[model samples]
Target: MESETYRGYNVWGHAILQQEAILAPERFAASGTITRNNKLVEASGVLGLFNAEAEAEQAGLAWALAWIDSHG
Candidate 1:
């Protein structure tokens, strides 16, 4: 239900999840830039600067699915 790495915008890294596709595939190394959703929540830090479009989309969907499985 998940992978080790993901891509988004211009970044890539480990993908974390919450519940119900709330938070997108966000990879951040900083301590700021927070993100949230109805069920998923997290932050898109510096890691986002090295992700690919497909990786990000895949991670995003994966994150959402994980969220649904966990919180749904």
Candidate 2:
């Protein structure tokens, strides 16, 4: 799990290890998880798909941070 810290929460990125063949073939899916005080607060469901893992991580981090900003 790759992660970033934002507003006292740990925003983590999850990579798709096993992709289903029926989904979009050109993109890879990723999710985000938010942890605060060593506890899980939120988990984003399939936030994005991208051509590269780095891209997915970037997008996931952005989404998680935005969620924190809006909901925190």
Candidate 3:
């Protein structure tokens, strides 16, 4: 998980590891959250699967920023 403040809102990016079988390559599930003043503003379901954790987290962050832009 990673956190950053944007436009007075706290944004969180998360990556969850997932594997279906022993031979399967590991993947990450991406999600995002937004908060203001310790209050929950929004959260996302799994955004997508990524081959790398960093990619997943970056996707989450991008989603959060886009959401903030559309809603703010």
72 Cα displacement, candidate 2 (Å):
2.5
Model 3 residue runs over 4 Å out of place are: none
lDDT of 2: 0.81
User: In what order do the candidates fall by TM-score, top score first?
Assistant: 3, 2, 1
Question: Whole-model Cα lDDT per candidate?
Answer: 0.35, 0.81, 0.95
Instruction: Note each model's CA RMSD in angstroms.
Output: 14.1, 2.9, 0.7
lDDT per residue, candidate 2, 1-72, as tens digits?
Answer: 579889899998866754567684556578889999999999889976788777787777888898999997
Sort the predicted structures by lDDT, highest score first: 3, 2, 1
Q: What would the per-residue lDDT of candidate 3 be over residues 1-72, giving only the tens digit for each residue?
A: 888999999999999999999999999999999999999999999999999999999889999999999998
**Each model's TM-score?**
0.32, 0.79, 0.95
TM-score of predicted structure 3: 0.95
TM-score of 2: 0.79
| Candidate with the greatest TM-score versus the true structure | 3
- Name the regions of candidate 2 deviating beyond 4 angstroms: 18-26
- The residue pairs that clash in candidate 2, if any, are none
Q: Model 3, poorest ten-residue lDDT window?
A: 54-63
